[model samples]
Target chain A: MKLTESLSFRNIKGRPVRTAVLIALTAIMAMSAICGSLAVMSLRNGLGALEARLGADIMTVPASAVSKQDFENIVLQGSKGYFYMDRSYYDKIAEREGIEKISYQLYLASASAGCCSVPLQIIGYDPDTDFTVSPWIRKSAGGELKELDVVVGNDLSVFVGETITFYGVTCNVKAKLDKTGNDLDTAVYTDIGTIKRLIAASLELGMNDFKDIDPDKVVSCVLIKVADGYSVDEVLNDLNLHVRRTKSFKTTDMISGVSESLAGVSGIIGILMAAVWVLVLVILFLAVYMSVNERKKEFAVLRVAGASRSRLAGIVMSETLIITITGAVIGIFLGLLMILPFNGLIEESTGLPFLLPDTLHIIICAFVALAASVIAGMLSSLGSAKRISRIDTGVILRGDN
Target chain B: MTITATGVCKDFIRQGKNTNKLTAVSPTDITIEAGKLYVLMGRSGSGKTTLLNMLAGLLTPSSGKVLCDGEDIYALDDEKLSRFRCEHIGVIPQGQTAVHSLNVLENICLSYMLYGSLKEREAAYPAARELMRKLGIAGLENEMPSALSGGELRRVAIARAMLRKPDVLFADEPTCDLDDENTALVLQTLKETAQSSTAVFVVTHERDAVGYADICLNMSGGSIGKQ
Candidate 1:
């Protein structure tokens, strides 16, 4: 018969349990593919963000900070605490032969005060000497920052033109950076004058750590760009040898470490997706095969009513396509429900970057996932369709009576 | 329309070391003419259903041809043969042929739907309703086959075969499990259908059906005997 929607619907509805099982299996397959793709895409975007944010070839932090919190916490986590070395280290690194550019930043954390909504990490850099954050600030703000103006991260609640008070020192938000899906999303960027004023205000507010700190003579970290024809390793070695009481790190090395950590998770999800698809394919094959076997007499009756073998095969394939397409749509919807609203929670629990693709890309991926499931269903039903096409109408009819 | 079978026979290969072949139906020649009811009466395993299946173009004969009108039905390939049968031949298979998922009306119009002649349910509903009424099943059109009585299901199958009004109609034990009244009703409908241009063939062991047939043949041990 013509493979109409009514025909497929009735066939599936006739065998409720079989249809339910097949749909469930196909849904699981689609769900696994969607969730897996989401995770892999997020990780890939997060890694890209991390690489772009770390514009420096090498970074030098106080040796004490490395001993206290290790490399990952200081660089990857965007730790709020700050430790500093003598400002003379900047001159020492600048004097090196292969140093193309060098900039130093002061890191400070706001006290938990009633004036602020949350304690935020504040990064203070010199606009004239900085190559890392200056280009972004210029692109976003279109001009240099005033003494008390600040650029906020995308995740912050404060908006441009709003004033945020840190330790009783208020600063105007000049611009907000886009989300990078990393620690930078929660940081604040400003000129050195703004952070020095905040530290002085913290001292006035009776903060003990700020009371003894000297913002003028101290530097938190130094970012260096290697000159052409000079490797990052050579610059790193030179900085380590010349700059006393500080440790130098290659940004590429830190990124490599982050990628290694992600490899394990990506591997697990890949295996899971593959396993689910294989299991779904086998279950669908068996379900269709058994369904066809049970309905041999029915097929014979249709043949007697003048249905060709190809028509019988079409019926079987149509039923499979209906189930698979329904299951795929449902699965994609469920995957979205699980992933979209709770992405922050996922990031927190996994300690990895979670960035969902844009709506267009997500829709494309969903369609591809759905098409894959339909193709899988068609392949699984091929054997059953062949069997139905080759059925002996007269033999089955005689046997049925 | 007339169905002519010439030197038709069927054999089954029994697999073993000896490879012996068993003949299911011996060589037989017969002609079933239009506007007449023909009944083949036989006990179980008498090859009555086999011969009926051959006449309906459902099986390929080992030797010889069964012609419908002027063309050998078997000479057509599978696709052409199926189309030809859909347009000109109808078979009401034995016992419980009703599809459980479809209502009586859907079952009645299944042949037209299968052959792509009827695309919409509305287009076939009138014909199906009329046939159901002729077979005394007018009210059961909306009821599922599972809810129908044994005789009602039989009538539904009969209505389905007759909906297309094929030139040849084959019914195999259509009245097997029906009560006497239902059986007589079914036989009378078959007789009325035979009075039209359609040729009717009924394979049954029911002695009562003999009274409704214009020509009756008795079958025993794979051979046909005129009675």
Candidate 2:
């Protein structure tokens, strides 16, 4: 072993209680940093996903689906369900003075029994009028989607060119969307013709629940883009007054509660991380101080044995660094163990989108956390190192008798 | 080399209310030459250790200069003085000076390692084992200081000091807590060390220490006199 390393190892090994306390405190600091950063990143990604996937200023749904509870479940919690509004609402909204664009969509759910990997929501849109899903489909799928071609969400198990069956009708997967960490992740997008054919197939198989409903006359929702000179409230007021049995909602307002909840959670985690840092720093300082105080005579002996003051200080600093590095490794390992494997469960329980950042992002965070731990160790040990450097060797050695 | 102390004294500031200053050691002149065992005899607080510390370059005298080979030792800065002591001076402190974590061999090689004279443990092990065997601790190289007797720890301290074969050896009460057999052994070792052309200064109240001295001095009430 190198001289400094051997000396530091011997010193740490000699004092078990001091070493253990320092390691434990540093571990707590690192663990808090990792977990807190993970949660904050997850929330940030979730909010970004919401912004990207919603892609519309306003949505008009059936009046029965206007409850705040249902709105939160569908928008924030990614729940799988379907509702409908009359197709006439889309025509009226599109002709309004302030409307820039309008598109209609139909929603349905697939059975869990051998349909796909899981029970999922399916959305069908008109390619000619769609302003949202069509742009992404064109960008990712390289062209317009045909009658039987479907784009799957990031969470689906199927790949491109694979087939997924819905009520005895199978469709080809053309492209896969990027992860949005929201309900869109579990959705499949196809043209309205496929949905109509699936509906007809269901009706033929004795699943006649849709026999009274005409696919051409009904839509689940209408997405609107207000004109440049008009505000969303102006269009919303006009739509609510002119349209019957339809409710308009701003996409931002629909998920404002979730945004507030995320802010609260992030604030708490920030405070918790700060508190852990303060506590760890205090404990580290105290532990090092006490250990140094107790070893005054030993330091004096080293001085008389021809050890320079800087060398003594280096020993103390080296011991602290070793403990900090050990703690950081263990703490980060535990953090990764708790987070990576159980991310889905955490998302379900928290009712928030939980996405692990990519490998490079995780690596950067771990490096930053480890660096912070090293800085903490250095800061906490500074006083002790200075004291060791300035100790009066003659007095200590002579007085020890 | 010869260590010369010219009217050196030490004064410490007392902490109590009058803020009085206490003179721990009165000014005294002494010369410690190589190839001699010099014993300074004093009771518990007679300034023997203070004078020894001054001579060993561990402390600065308040009044006079401690010169080694005609160069004032106190003129060197802390760093240079530390290097000088590492290469030229060795001190066995009053009691229990072993670093408790290191075993016997590591303890013996510690001084050489601290001074960077030996870069690797392998380079230090042969010398350390030779010293340990000379001190009658041949088979105890792997034993911890905590498991050793008082005499054994003292021998380890002595081995550490002598590892670099310094010119001057200053031992403050080297046999303070030892039985008759260990005391004799320790004194005989110091006697043998002094005869090997090193200046050995031993501060002790033990009468037996005087028998091993080539020159003896008595200390009383912060003053020294020839014995």
Candidate 2 structure quality by residue, lDDT tens digits, A261-309: 7888889989999999998898899989998998888888888988888
Which pairs of residues have clashing backbones in candidate 1? Answer: none
TM-score per model over all chains: 0.92, 0.93
Screening candidate 2 with a backbone cut-off below 3 angstroms (N, C-alpha, C), the clashing residue pairs are none
The TM-score obtained by model 2 is: 0.93
lDDT of 2: 0.84
Which ranges in model 2 have alpha carbons more than 4 Å from their true place?
A: A1-5, A16-21, A68-70, A76-78, A202-214, A240-245, B15-18, B117-120
**Poorest stretch of ten by lDDT in candidate 2 chain A:** A68-77
Cα-based lDDT at residue A29, candidate 2: 90
Q: How accurately is candidate 2 docked according to DockQ?
A: 0.61
Off by over 4 Å in 1: A1-5, A67-74, A77-83, A86-91, A95-97, A111-113, A238-245, B14-20, B116-120, B134-138
Best by DockQ: 2
- Write the residue-wise lDDT of candidate 1 on A201-278 in tens digits: 877777877676788888888899999999889878877887778899998887787787678778988998999999
